[model samples]
Target: MTQIIRSLDEIAPNYDVLFCDLWGCLHNGVAAFPAAVAALQDFRAQGGRVVLLTNAPRPQQYVAAQLDRMGVPRDAWDAIVSSGDAAQDAMFAGAVGRRVWAIAQPKDEGFFTDIPEEWRDAPPITRVPLDEAEGIVCCGLFDDLTEVPEDYRGRLMLARERGLTLLCANPDVVVDMGEKRLYCAGALAELYEDLGGTSLYFGKPHPPIYDLARRRLGLDDNARILAIGDGIATDIAGAAGEGLDALFITGGLAFDQFGPDVENPDPARLAEWLALRAQDPAYSIGRLR
Candidate 1:
């Protein structure tokens, strides 16, 4: 049974840190949620560390820059841990091999160029044509706004024939960008796996990203950490997998399932929805605030 709470302050004191999601919880991909930002600020004012644990397929620095553009103030979070950072580590270490085919947008070039300080001495990774590649690196769709997973079926089929392992940067199937829903790298990976291709995931709902977040926190294993997000399969599932408390924001991906009102969720409807998904978050809120 999960409890429906009004605000984060109700449970803020119980947690030493928060591993918050970016896309849907803190913002709608266009602007920062004023209440969400304020809640995190208040949490930090009380000495709790807030780490924006996002599944964005780019390094923390790039994500941070995007947050800056979205008006997510610096005081709201202590750090950021992204899927790209984790996948980049595996990539440079030859997890996807040295020569690979990249499925990403022009904005995602930083995934290769911006090497973290510690990884500067790592082996070089080069991007080549699909026919000459040993693996596939899927940062995201070349154009998320206009593309769907099915659009890449032909290319993925070719990669599968070659037995290329796809390294998925973000394991989110879909994310709401303001009023529009966009396909992410995970959607392509899911399609690839359906096509009998091997896909490696490093984001939420997987241990790699959580491990990176824990490393960033630098806290004892027993430290109280709350994971906040709206993605049922990615955020809530990841929190459950990590044995951490989760705060589910109903207004993101599954906003309509909780009844007519977006802010005020119908308890029974919320319960039934969660039950259907087999997810038992510690707390549920209409929004992150």
Candidate 2:
């Protein structure tokens, strides 16, 4: 039986580090959740370290700026680690050579800022035609608001025919933006894989990002770190794979499936849902507060 927690105060002392998810748990795509911020502040006040681990395809600085714009308190977290950081490491470590095709928004160019001048050719990362590219880097949809994954079928097929390896910076398929659900870079990557194309994903549910977070937190291998997030496949599964405790937030992406009672969900239904995914979160909460 999973314990349903209404307040994080109940388990704050049991863990030393918190690996918190940003997109759905801390805020919707539009704004910050005040209670979630307050909870992290209170946790930090009690000497617990909070690290924001997100699947956002952009660099940590970009995520910080977005958090600031959304009015999330600066003190709510101690550090931020993003999938883009991991992807940058992969790119520099010879994941993709000089010339590459980029399928991302203009604002997501921060993923390539870490590449040194000498390592890259004239144009480090190009958004030009795929035919002139050696590899592909997908951070997000060219236009997420107006486009879906299906819109890129033709492009993906072309890349597949050329046998280009696609590096997916973000592994999340969808994220809740206000009341609407937006497709992420992972969706496009999945489509590419379906078309017999090779894809390298760098994000949650993959061990690399968790390893980065563990190093950032400076915690021992056996340290009690609690991961809190809404995505069952990404957040909960990632934590479980890392052998860390996870706190499932039902109010985020899983709210609709879990039901309308954000504060209290049917235990049987919740258990059944988790069982299907083979995940067992240490604790379940409606919201971070």
Candidate 3:
């Protein structure tokens, strides 16, 4: 059945916990969506718990600080959990004292600096390497992991033969990057798994990250949660899979990929779009602002 909501107020009475999406649903990376911010603020004032759930590949604290700068008040929500947090947790899990091979941008290497000194930071290649490491942790893609070539298969296979565990910081296959659709880390990780390498992913649309939010927010399974986001694959699919209602914000993540604007999305197209992924978020909202 189809569902619709005209205003944020309509959501409060139906939900005790709100698992809102960032980016398009709340604001563009550079600016905050005013309507979204107000809605969240109203939710908290009514004694509801608001947990900001995002697929961002950065830590939750960093995301919070960035949002704060964009005008999201500290009181806007109860807590947050980002894909990056899960990546960090997985990176530290047994990986703290062990060696790891990473394929990420220069800026992203810091995520691994916290690893124990005893382990090694195996030399990085856009593709796999000849030398072995205890595990592999991926953050961003080189040439965008989404567009990797057939040749890289051999490199991934080499890592697998060595039996190294693989880590994917961003579990997105692709994302709406303002102007273009770019590949994400999960694409390469999937290939590695197909190559016989073991891979672990941390990000949206995944049950683990959602599970973490469940504990932090103290939200019961029966709680009516509204998850709003831009990406149908991660935000909508993940939340729906977890038995929560969701709102699809058109222009946030895949704004450019789908059409002209994410802020004002075409609901008919969106509904059909998400149906392919089996994602049926409760409503299709224009945007936060």
Candidate 4:
């Protein structure tokens, strides 16, 4: 049974490390949550390490820059492991062909150009038109603010016909960007699979990202780890797959299902919802606090 808790302090001593999600738990795209920030800071002060594990589809440096821009202080967490970092490793290793088609926004262009020092000897990757590409690299939608997955059905169909494998950078289908929900790279990847195309994911709920996170954590396998996030499919599911305890944040994506009080989730409703989904997180909280 999952226990609904009031704050992280109640259970902090049980775990030595935290694999925290970024989007809904720590920040809401626009700004960092003060309570969530403080909770993580407090965890570190107690000698517990915090790793910001995210499916942001950008390298850790860029994600760190984004956090800086979003007012998420550096002291709140110890390290960051991003899906982009994992996917980039695969891409540079030629998991997909050298000449590929890129589906991303201007902000995501850094994913292609900012090759880490480690990948310097790897084959050069060039972005070509869909018709001329050997594989597809999906960082995100070209315009997440104004586009949806269906917008690329025709193009995806052509790629399917060619048997091109799509490398999905982010495996989050949707995210609440403040008050607006936006489609992500995973949405397009899902659509591609639905249309008889192949899509590869290197994000949450996938083994590759988790493997990379463990390495970044630099902890022994025996270290007690907890995963805290609002994404049921990505963060929570990923934690479950990795045999890590999960702290489900109800206030992030599924706030409405827990009744009108966002800070105090309805226990019965939360129980029923988790039962319906067959997810038994170790603990549940309205927010990170």
Candidate 5:
């Protein structure tokens, strides 16, 4: 059974490190959550280290810039890790091929900056049509706010016909952008997979990102790291995969399934829902506060 807590203060002292999620747990797409930021500040004041782990397709510096723009305090976290970093590292290590088709908005080109010039093959990192590419790297949709997974059926089908391997930079299906939900790269990846295409996910619920997080924190395998996030499929499942405890925040993207009141979701129903998804979060809260 999951403990429905009112605040993270109740369990803050139990962990040495906090593997915090950035998008949904700390903020919506537009602004920072004051309470969540304050909670991390207080946790760090007590000597605990907080690391912001995000599935953002860009590197940590890009995410830091966005967080600073949104007024998420610098002192709220000690370090940052992103799925883009993992993907870039994989590309550099020769895990992914060089002739690539990037499927993302123009603003998302930062995700490929780390691919060394010497390592790339001839005609590297093209934004051309999928038919002309050897592999695919999907950071996100060209327009997340206006598009859904259905909007990419034709493109995904074409990619499937070519048998291109896709590398999904972000594993989140959807995220809350203020009050509205925006489709993410994971939704498109899922659609591609359903159409018999192979996809390599780079973020949460995958081993590579967690491995990077653990190394960034300089922690051993047995460290008491607590992962806090709103997504059960990504955050909670990721923590469980890495043998860490997780705290599920209900006020983020999963608010609809929780109940009418986002702040006070029915615990019984939430538990049943988690059970249905085969997720077992050690603790749950309406919000990070």
Candidate 6:
């Protein structure tokens, strides 16, 4: 492994493309991190392509709009790719008799607004209600686990036995929803798979999302690309799997062992964690302004 001894100051000169994860890295899904936004701007000013790769189960456009509204400079990213776009692609151009009972919060349904006209007029995609459906497309798990009626589980299994394909838009088990830890669709989809059903996953730690990340940059020519994210399981693992340098952010979505995370931990904690486990990241500590 080639260790680069990186800090935010040295990130851009060191890499040609930077693949960053949204939600945890740049924003808390509700606001943008000023320093995080500045880092991308600095990288772009230095001639690097910035691609924000996210597990958000919405199309790239939606991600861009959200960032734009949050004061994230539009040019901070050269392009964006998301798990939602991948799932939409997997739908095979809206074939007849195909339906997806969307199991997610209402706000995220906007991602499906661009569905084809041929699909249907009953909202193209209906909420994945706890009953019969042709197939399931999970955007997120319902927040209250205890309130998840048994009827919901039955329908999932029934659909699976009938050979329905359960497509997962976002694959994270949970994301820090402000101060509350809300469940994501990935958790429910995993449970379904455990019951002998197969699932199509979109997002980081999955192949398609990374492929999109590379494509957006037209990556090649020894153009070093760095993937920066806040999670070990998704961003770091996904970037490493795709043979890209990874910069892990320790100051975002993740919570400490007890209570809520009131403050963000710094990059030194990332180095300490890696060193304690005899692991190493190409860079260490905060690199962005």
True-structure RMSD, every candidate: 0.9, 2.1, 4.7, 0.8, 2.1, 4.5
Model 2, TM vs. native: 0.94
Clashing pairs in 1: none
lDDT of 6 at 150: 41
lDDT of 2 by residue, 1-289 (tens): 5688889999999988899999878999888888999999999999999999999998788999999999998889999999998887777666865578888887987777656444565444544568998889889899988899999999899999998999999999999889888999999999999999999988998999988888877878777799999989899999888888899998888887777687787788899998888888999998888
Clashing pairs in 2: none
Which stretch of 10 consecutive residues in model 6 shows the poorest summed lDDT?
257-266
lDDT of 4 by residue, 140-183 (tens): 99988999999999999999999999999999999999999999
> Which stretches of candidate 3 lie above 4 Å from their native place?
95-97, 113-130, 142-154, 194-196, 254-267
Candidate 3 residue-wise lDDT, 202-268, digit = tens: 7888887888888877767677787777777888788778877777776566555455755455566
Q: Residue pairs in steric clash, candidate 4?
A: none
Which stretch of 10 consecutive residues in model 2 shows the poorest summed lDDT?
A: 116-125
- The 10-residue segment with the lowest total lDDT in model 5: 118-127
- Give the CA lDDT, 0 to 100, for residue 260 in model 4: 96
| Tens digits of per-residue lDDT for model 6, 237-282 | 7777777777766555443521233243344444456555454446
Pull out the clashing pairs in model 5: none
Q: Summarize candidate 5's per-residue lDDT along 241-284 as a digit string, tens digits.
A: 98889999988778888889888879889989999999988999
Candidates in order, TM-scores: namely 0.98, 0.94, 0.80, 0.99, 0.94, 0.80
lDDT of 4 at 283: 97
Question: Candidate 2 — which residues are off by over 4 angstroms?
Answer: 114-127
Give the backbone clash total of model 6: 2
Global lDDT for candidate 1? 0.93
lDDT of 2: 0.87
Q: Residue by residue across 1-289, what tens digits does model 1's lDDT show? A: 8999999999999999999999889999899999999999999999999999999999999999999999889999999999999998888888989899999889999998887778788778899999999999999899899999999999999999988999999999999888999999999999999999999999998999999888887978889999999999999999999999999999989998998988889999999999999999999999988
TM-score of 6: 0.80
User: lDDT for each of the candidates?
Assistant: 0.93, 0.87, 0.72, 0.94, 0.86, 0.69
Q: Alpha carbon lDDT of residue 186, candidate 2?
A: 93
**TM-score result, candidate 1:** 0.98
